[model samples]
Target: MLGRLAVDVAIYRDRVQVTERKSGIFIDQRADHPFSSDTQLVADATRFEHALSHALRQILKTGAYMLYEPRAVVGPTDPALTPPERALVRRVLQDTGFRRIEFEDE
Candidate 1:
């Protein structure tokens, strides 16, 4: 792969035992610890290359917290996503049926 892809996700078993596309990476530091998702790059792999450096930075910065926080809620306090990153996020969330909740910076 020419680019780097990362995600932060939660893992859940289904009724049917099937291999699924893993959207996250896991760090098994302890038995109590659970597998975590890679939430850094929520975009498709092809596009992830565009933000590889940023995504890697995010992963390195937040890797330790992945198990505790699998999902990220982007608030105004959250640094704004770059134009391309925002577009990618919007596209992915829309595809997954997540309502785009845009809020103005108060």
Candidate 2:
């Protein structure tokens, strides 16, 4: 492989973005509406996971097959997270096939 690809993920209550560090390649998606919190930021587990998984899939689609599982540096979410929220966040990352997950300090 030419090099490793890592990414930064920012998941807000209403949106989520996954950006490849070197190329600035990214996928940013909003919830169904301005007032909707479809990403749910770890609240609605199913929707949150689906939203994140979709974004991560876009990243994978970019490289086709050469990219390794990315290490995602997930920053603090917009609405803040509780202990359970953190665990759910990890679960989403793991389910999405990220090689590693480093949650930013709050």
What is the Cα-based TM-score of model 1? 0.28
Q: For candidate 1, lDDT tens digit of each residue in 18-98? A: 111143443322212222124332324333322332333444454343332122223332333446545664454344333
* Candidate 2 structure, TM-score to reference: 0.77
Question: Which regions in candidate 1 have their CA more than 4 angstroms from the true location?
Answer: 1-73, 77-79, 103-106
Worst 10-residue lDDT window for candidate 1 reads 11-20
* Candidate 1: residue 50 lDDT (0-100): 29
Q: For model 2, which pairs clash?
A: none
Give TM per candidate.
0.28, 0.77
lDDT of each: 0.32, 0.72
Q: What are the per-residue Cα lDDT tens digits for candidate 2 across 1-106? A: 3546688988776677888887788899665433224544556666777777677678767774444776889888767776888888788777777778898874
Clashes of each: 10, 0
